[model samples]
Target: MLPVGHFAGPMFIAPDAVEPESYEVRYEDGVFSLSAAEYAVWALAHGDPDRVGSHRPTRQALTAEAEATGVTEPAVTIDALISDGLLALIEDEPAARRAFAERHQLMPLALGLGNQPSQLGVFQIGMPNTPRVSVGYDIYHMWLFCHRERTLWAAVQEIAGEAQEANDAAPAGDVELIADVDDLLAGLIEALPILLSTSCGFLDPRRPSPTSAPADDAAGSGDDGRGEDPAEDHEHGGDALVAQP
Candidate 1:
């Protein structure tokens, strides 16, 4: 079965600014008018917006649903969306784990502090080419952990280990700090889109290629013959002014 994966980046449907009948789609760095077929397929694929991270619908199921909804050329639309990078495909959990182990791949984007850095070391984190969001300390720590550990599961394990170590080192009477593995993993998965929405992170796919460059360099290759702002050359769209809000 071909399992559909959650979008690696941010995608939201909102009212179109000009067209009353059409909808606006904010995907990655570009804003485009949404098509009925696209919306239908997307809605069918993402049954519940809140649980998209854990959900992986098969292409066939989505196509059948789309056909039921009267979406013309359902298969075509689904394939197009996947090709456009708005959707992805993975074989299964075991396959994903194997690929991840071999590649140690995770987020392909970079994180940066928002315009206003907090005085309490709680700076807002986001991307340079998109609006920055205040994702709080925990989210920031998770991103840092992923960056250091090179994978989400590994990061969670490392954090859990640290919590255990902290509790072990505490005095006999002191309260033990607890880090629930399931809760931490769930929270991280939930916050992933927010991180991706900021354009500060993305899911790294498994493929035959050279090792990745540094995140900072990936964000903006100052020299190296590439443009000053790497966001300018994004595959999906051009550079967008980072919203100050």
Candidate 2:
């Protein structure tokens, strides 16, 4: 069992907390966007949601793992994981363990199907009584963890190897095509959210009406006592302005 107060950490992050960094993976015209940290968290949560219930390790254990993995700071890593929606804090150890296992099993399968490499690799850390998912790597330096089982890392490495093999089997022609298509697709992807937002009325740049206006007054309307229409001010005349003598 985890220590007495290990589960007492904050359940939810504050709104002002740092946002996860996002990455876009483009294939042809379709683009999938996710944060690096989120990808890590997803691997964890998808594999096992129950893992969050385990007793957290001492600061020393975390520090040792971080140093070995080049993480330098455990808090930053934890924050990034939480921000990515991969992991969560829960009060129940059994539930957390189950969740963590589920996440571990699912993540490799998902990545394998998508034909992408699994960057994060699982590792165990800390004392035997209260072992935890220590920071570790796979092909890349991405961190991974599985709190429920000590053998999870070994399984993850095997799965990662399979994923790498699948990714490697693509034809050279297909690779070039994907590369060319992704380059063209990038500009469209970056512009898409802005385009959609503008298309929707919700993101209009117009200002809100003052509180002095009637409750029914729409946003951006003028406040003249004479009830001059604000919409009329937006009308454009074809002729340029000219000075009169």
For all predicted structures, in order, the TM-scores are: 0.42, 0.20
- Model 1 regions lying over 4 Å from their true place: 1-105, 108-110, 114-123, 127-131, 167-178, 206-245
Runs in model 2 deviating more than 4 A are 1-63, 88-92, 98-245
Candidate 1 CA-lDDT value: 0.48
Per residue, candidate 2 scores C-alpha lDDT tens digits across 1-245 of 11100111121236674432232322111222333332222222222213332423333443343444333344565554343222344333444433332332111101211111453343333234443233222311112122212222333344445445655786665422122222222322222122222111001112232454433443222232213222122212122111110
Candidate 1, residue 101: lDDT: 31
Find the 10 residues in a row with the least total lDDT in model 1. Answer: 236-245
**Top of the candidates by lDDT:** 1
In the range 151-196, model 1's lDDT, one tens digit per residue, is: 4566666776777788889999976644665555555555654454
The global C-alpha lDDT for each of the candidates, from Candidate 1 onward, is 0.48, 0.27
Q: Which predicted model would earn the best TM-score? A: 1
RMSD each, Å: 10.7, 24.1
Error of 1 at 14 (Å): 34
